[model samples]
Target: MMKIDIPTMRAQMAEGDKKRDTGLTEPTTITAIKELSYGPHGIENTFDIYYPVGTTTCLPTIVSIHGGGFFYGDKELYRFYTMYLASQGFTVVNFNYRLAPVHQYPAPLEDTNALMNWLLIHGKEHYVDTEQLFLVGDSAGGQLAEQYATLTSNPHYAGLMDFAIADVQFKAVGLNCGAYFIGQTGAINQDFPFYFGETLPEQTAQQFPVESFITTDFPPAFITTATHDFLKDVAEPLATILRSKGVEAEFHLYENPDGKELHHVFHLDQRNPIGKQCNEETLDFFRKFL
Candidate 1:
């Protein structure tokens, strides 16, 4: 296991307080579906769906997973951003998966995949386009999106899985300040052992490595991060690995003029120029691809 300083982690999180000054508000158009069975875990496996004002058919779909260092956060936290994407002619699905310390590695990953399977099976009923699927996630959620994409693309895994997931393909993926490496140290590590359990083997844990999963068949990706954020190094390394494998991956690094901005603040502060720019860049990227 890699060693990390507790005091340093606290200090880095404290720097994110700068986002509190930005005037960001929650979305009013979101409607929560508190009950959409996604996994065998029963009640906790539900997902929330967000859509535009008017009815539509064949619209693009985006699945958004929230970030909480893998141990915290809920589907409600990302309602605004999901609604914003919905407004742009895309159907948005925001779901809750079991967090770490409570559940573990494959648990959360399975929950996410189950939710996608559910959507693919019943998407048309909700006016969602099953054929046009895209994924967007922030922080740990971004990591999950990447992992899920890789799993779906790999014939060995997806083919053998008994889940309800159809052969539906992903159009594109957008990862913002994601922790590409789950079990590794540096920026991505944050009490990951609590999720995998203390007795789990190293080789077993390595299966979740985000960088190693990238493949030539993987969908196009748009990765972004800030200079002051600890995760700045995470996106570039993964992008490099993807490119080496002949995958189409694009990367962007945004630096905050104020030194106080930390990782995972883009969705929290909508008024900040940096936050708006991040949203714009992400939306533009998806629009072009989807």
Candidate 2:
């Protein structure tokens, strides 16, 4: 496969995250099913499902998309955090999607579709109540989650995609430190090929934004960011747009703790008290529609 030529920034970022999660330990209260493949990409397409150890009945499910600026991250990186979510009473699916430069636009989206289908087939056997499904993503994963949710809800946008839409109803979505408005930023003009694998025509570009494709059918959302997150500016605008379209939108901007700015995806760090607080609030938001 001819991969796109990109910088080593992804590697550097991955190292940083590994360091961030180094000392954290997952709680023993949850049960985990690991390394199940949903697509043909071997380990890259594999997933892990987490739920409370003694769960007897199906529970509300949260399918989480991992962050890495579209080029990095995996189920293992989210292992502890997803376990924490499970401990709090939910079945959580965390998985790896094909990354960019190696696998371009729509690959992760398609993988997301495959994962959903996989759940539809295997979910009941594993305590996933697909009927009460929800989506969550951070950073680049946020973009993928938002886009996938839009496709599931909006027929007009779903028609433009290459694959059949995944048949799943999302109760809500959590967009954490994510970019929701694409192409509105000038970077899209040049970064298109790097991520999407082609230069889009002006009209197509205009039609491709996550915001533009969102409809009233879009799932209710919990959008969040910290004072220092680069994507902090995106959450409010996305909530505004969703509200304009009659979708329920709850946006939260976290203030710094002890006057220290919180970086992007700070909620992923289980050690951070503020991150835990944010997760609890996000869970409360998801529970509302349940």
Among the numbered candidates, top lDDT falls to: 2
By summed lDDT, which 10 consecutive residues of candidate 2 come out lowest?
1-10
Q: In model 1, what lDDT does residue 210 have? A: 55
TM-score against native, each model: 0.82, 0.94
| Candidate 1 accuracy as TM-score | 0.82
Per-residue CA lDDT of candidate 1, range 1-290, in tens?
A: 54445355545644553345335554555433445666777655877776765555657888888876666666756666677777666788888889766687667777887777788788777767877888888887888888878877776545434454446678888888887876555323344665566677554555655566567888888888877667777889878877898877889887677676545546445556777777777778777775
Query: In model 1, which residue pairs have backbone atoms overlapping below 3 Å?
Result: none
lDDT for predicted candidate 1 compared with the true structure: 0.71
User: Model 2's lDDT to the true fold?
Assistant: 0.86
Please report, in order, the local distance difference test score of every candidate based on alpha carbons: 0.71, 0.86
**Candidate 2 structure quality by residue, lDDT tens digits, 1-290:** 22433467767777887888998777778888888889899999999989998999999999999988777778898888788888889999999989876887778999999999999998998899999999999999898889999999988888887789889989999999997677775545354465665565554454467778888999999999999999888889999999999999998998765888888999988888889999999899999988
